[model samples]
Target: MSTGFIILALITIAGAIGAMNCGRLVHCALSLVASFAGLAGIYLQLNVWFVGVAQILVYVGAVAILIVVALLVTRNAESDRQNEGSKGWIAGGSVALLVFILLAGALSNTAVTGAATLAPDSSVETIGRRMMTLYVIPLEALALLLTAALLGAVVIALGGPKPGRASK
Candidate 1:
């Protein structure tokens, strides 16, 4: 592996660990962003330009920022953390180990078949055209869905009726 790939992998692993172990929601969100960015860099290094850019744009740009903003707006992150006292680490670890063993056994029994490769036909333009023409409705629906979700988050954060407002 290249030095750049090794660096990116290390960053990704560190960020993932921080995201999972950090006590504060804001710190965890920031660590998740670091992990997303490092994965994007690794994708770019692997020459998958579209996926890398999409990772950076959609994950790092949109999702992580939205999470941070939502956490800030709610302003109850610490209180929730206090409420969630014990995290049952032993049970979680045991389940994870069980799943890993099952997956390893399954993979060990699977046969690898080598197939002839086909020429590359997917370009950025083709993907863009497909998105604009074939999948526009789904795309617009997803945008509307995300907008509704954002509005819902804001409403929840506001804690219902305000002091000067009347409820119907």
Candidate 2:
């Protein structure tokens, strides 16, 4: 593996660990941003520029912002710690172990194959054209969806309309 790839992978892993283990939800969301950034770097290093851009746009920009907004909007002054017991840890560990075993088995059985590779410039241009033409509807729909989500988050943050107040 390349040194850049190794570094990106470490960033991804460390961010994921920090996100999982952080005590505060906002810190976890920030760590998730780092993880998403590392994944974007990995995609860029692999020469899939569109996917890398989408990774940054979707995960880092939209999702992480949404998470932080939700956390902030719903947070309480009281400590949010939960007293998780040993059984919870044991169950979580077992589930993680099972998932790891399943993933390892699937990866070990997969075969790598060579596929046709295109120039990055031409690929990006083709993608852009398609996005403007064939995929325009879906892209617009996604934008609308994100807008609605943001509006909903704002409404939630404002605790919805007052129960007994008249309309302005």
CA lDDT, every model vs. true structure: 0.86, 0.87
Local accuracy of candidate 2 as per-residue lDDT tens digits, 1-168: 689999999999999998987877778899999999999999998888889999999999988998887787788876455455779768998999999999999988999675757645647789889989999999999999989988997788678667678575
C-alpha root-mean-square deviation, each candidate: 3.9, 3.4
Q: Best candidate, TM-score-wise? A: 2
Q: For model 2, where is the 10-residue window of minimal lDDT?
A: 77-86
Residues 1-168 of candidate 1: C-alpha lDDT, one tens digit per residue: 579989999999999989987877788999999999999999887667888899999999999988988888778635546544456767787998999999999999999685645534456998889889999999999999999998998899679787667654
C-alpha displacement of 61 in model 1, angstroms?
A: 2.3
